[model samples]
Target: MFGVLGPNGAGKSTVLRILMGLWHAQAGSVTFQGARLPPPYDALRAQAGVVFQRATLDDLLTARENLLASGRLYGVRGPRLNERVTELLKVAGLVDRADERVVTWSGGMKRRLELMRALLHRPKLLLMDEPTSGLDEAAFRTFWVQVSRLRMQEGLSVLVSTHRPDEAQKCDRLTVLDEGKQLVTNTTAVLSRYVGGDVVTLEVESPDVTAAVLRASLKVDARVVDNTVRIEHPEGHALIPRVFEALDRGTVKGVTLRPPSLADVFFHLTGRALSSRVSNEPEPMTIRTEGQP
Candidate 1:
């Protein structure tokens, strides 16, 4: 599975639409199974399924109804269609609510149903855009569990787009995009190796003072944001005693330190914090026109 990791307006969704043939790209061609995609793109689309960021199921329709409709659209029917729906229900853990209306389903359940709908055709490639956006911790765990199982059972080639660093870490590989351009694509391990250190966050009343002392004493990189002084050190823990000694003489408040995370990797590459940079505004999933560039 491939992943697109970027901020809200970084054009991840735009790329997905182009791949799906719902929109076209001006500068590049999309190939499927090693062939340049043709017009109409029906052949290419048949091999793919998409789950949008927002719920697409009919509110009045039951879970089973939604799946059956999707299967019908894919020309699946009779015992085979029923069997497939049943299997997907079990996979998504929605069997108990198979007859429940979508309007009554919880956010997680609706998301699962959408996933099941996308899988109804058993497409070779599955594209998901922010599939776990509004889910709680428990729901997120359940979603990933099902995803891992599906990947193994169906050998599905999955591509997911998300802004969450933790979610990006779970993917097999990641494509980090910024401002409509691909920055880097690699495994989590490879990216982490570049970090080569732990992250030290100091919650001090006077961040400027703490940053000054750390800069003078340690051969490290540091920055201040949100009243917190963040430092990157190869041996971050080893520097704690020295840091404490220095902060003790200043107007310090608190300190926190930890190993490098995906967030740190993002900051190191982008020169900005991921959480702080992404907009809180709800972004709509829309198609990008092709050949406009």
Candidate 2:
């Protein structure tokens, strides 16, 4: 599994559209298996499966019917198609809901159905856009279990795009992007190469005061965001006691120290705040099945 990971408006979906032959890059071209991808994707369409960020199913159609429709679109038919659909439905844990219309299903169920529908033709490459969006931890893990099984058994190449940092951690490999530019690509184990040491985040009564005091006395670099004092230190545990000792009593309320996150890596690279929820409009991070924009 590969992930194109980034915050909102980072152009992860744009890259995916280019890869799926739905959009053209302004400058560079895309190559797969040493062959340049041309526009229209006449030959590639049949070999690639896609699960959009939104649910593409007809709510009025039964789950099984939806799969049949999608299968026929890919030229799958007869006993082979029926057998494939049945096999996928069972694998995706939707056999019980196969005959039921999707309108009554939960978000998790809809997502599972979409995944199954995407594989109706058994495309070699699967492209998922925010496949886990809106799912709780349990549902998210459940969905990935099916994906993992497919990878292990079928040797499928899955490319997924995600805004959630935790979801990106599940990728076999991922690329971090910012403002449409690629930052780095590496395995998750070594992705932290960009982040130096541990980060200690403190929620104090006065962030400015705490930051100023730390800089003036301990000479540590502290930055304030949303009334929180955040510091990254090589020896974060050692700096904790020193920070508390240097500050006046009751000046500090809480402090947490841990390894850096992908957000921290983004901040380190571009100095941009990654946690800001600027867009209420959901961009392919997950499926908003109600069709709200």
lDDT of 1 at 254: 65
lDDT of 1 at 114: 89
Q: Candidate 1, which segments miss by more than 4 Å at Cα? A: 248-250, 277-293
lDDT of 1 by residue, 199-263 (tens): 88887877887788778876557688656888888888887777877666655556788888777
> Deviation in angstroms for 18 in model 1?
1.7
Give the Cα error of residue 120 in candidate 1, in Å: 1.0
RMSD of each: 9.4, 6.8
- Indicate which candidate wins on lDDT: 2
- Colliding residue pairs in candidate 1: 24-290
Model 1 poorest 10 in a row by lDDT: 277-286
- Per-model TM-score on C-alpha atoms: 0.89, 0.89
